[model samples]
Target: MKHLLFLYLGVVSSFASDTRPLKERVNEFCQKHRSIAEIEKRHAEWIKQEPDNPDAYILPANALAKAAETVNIVAGDQKDAIAVLTDPKTGKQVGSIAEGPDPAIIKRAEDILKAATKKFPQRLDIHVGRMAMSQRIKDTEAVTTAALDLLATAAKDPQTLRWIDNEQIDGVPLKKALEEVEARIRWLYSFEKDETDKFAQDCALKALELAPGNVELLNFAAIRHLYRGEWKEGREYLLRAEIAAPRDWIVQHNIARASAELGDKADALKRLQAVIKAVPGTDDAKAAEASIKSLGLDVPK
Candidate 1:
């Protein structure tokens, strides 16, 4: 998904200038599935060739983000499983957990993004790169800061509405792209600070006002209410989400959770079972199973 976002960024950049040659090079590099080392080397050369160009920084930053994501996938999978290392001399076996990506790589990516943002403060792609890198590293503070920066930029850009009306990004409507940014802002605020609840709610409300039928934003609003222990309000929003997206497993899962939290065990179990039946072998189904077990109800086989 992040890779696709980077490609979309490339496409968007193409619209800004007649840099077809450079864009082609980037697309070629990405399509060839070059090693991170090769990508770093080529992107460094590009940066040296065009130190003032934002694309120089953006390309390498994206490559670095991809590298970070790849490493994280390996590390996360390893962390979920056990690995045993055997000593040659004493034949001793020791179990160890997998390590995360090298901090130096992440730092390098961040430095490139920071430098890009500093040089081209108005460029939305630079901030998006920063946000993606921050998320890869699980840096909540950095993510929130980047998200806020993105929101501020989008809000102030007069061309945003025009872009939404006419542009398409990776086959997604520009309006949906704007909604995605707004949704991310809401998500970031949810984790930012307790005092940011109002900010989160306001952002969600504003996003819904702009794109009222956005199920994800509606679900976010519902979760925010649930976070505040307002089950009735949460359920109301969830129902709205359901109306907007009836087959969305996440909405049903949240409804089940809300019901369980409200002491409606029978309803909770029924909703969870429905979710399981509707979306078997999915994350939501697994969550529903767990919720049922938490309620001391047997999952229907």
Candidate 2:
């Protein structure tokens, strides 16, 4: 019996570790505008491989839900719609006998949180996840209301404080207070001094803890790192942000600068060539092409 129990535990542990890279790869693919078919395949594989992971189910559902925008409204084909999810890749249909929305991801992230809350009633992340979704929808009333509810609940549990305060992935404890989030916003208001940039920098870092792999947050962090001449850290995050938001010209240049800083001339030239090739006729593109020329590169025609 002891050996059997140990084997079971080992299997569970290995399964959990394996899922980490799968999630990261999904996030990376999303950033790079990978095809729905690809993400869908991987997502489908994840649910199959780790059927018990509620979060894995949620990831694919959320991805399709947002892009497909399956809202509270249902179509006349409701029975069939719920019967099988329309495959985002091949435009085919897949039916899972699980019943309900083919990928009843979450009608809203709140649903996921509610489920999470039941399991971890004490977990502040469950509350924050819901609140974060509320903010995404620009539901100010909802954000304020839900945040208040969480603030009250977290007050009774010091463990929840880091969730809002500290800047860590998988979420912070309730780290600081709602006041801190607000204060960061307030600081964004017409303060002409350099201090605004500092607060934005601080808030950007804080945002990453809550929403890891966020391109906007990564860009902000990269800018701060650039200002401080922290080339290595700045370059790594910029590369990630580049994958996330390729159209951002600033990110393109940052990649070049990072490569130059690292003395990787080949990589620097190649990226610069890509940027210039992406927009050949523009004055800005021309200037970038010149920068590549300065690198002694043979510009790709």
Q: Which candidate has the highest lDDT of all?
A: 1
Identify the candidate with maximal TM-score: 1
- TM-scores of the candidates are 0.53, 0.36
RMSD (Å) of each candidate, 1 decimal: 8.1, 17.5
**lDDT of model 1 at residue 31?**
62
At residue 156, give the lDDT of candidate 2: 65
Question: Candidate 1: minimum summed lDDT over ten consecutive residues — where?
Answer: 160-169
| lDDT of each residue in 166-282, candidate 1, tens digit only | 233334333544555665556566565655555566556655655678887787677668887899899988988888898888888788778877888788888888888987898
Candidate 2 structure quality by residue, lDDT tens digits, 49-161: 77554444334434443443333333224442435456699876544322222223223434544444444444444455555544343444444444545545555664533
Which whole-number lDDT from 0 to 100 does residue 284 have in model 1? Answer: 83
lDDT for each candidate structure: 0.62, 0.52
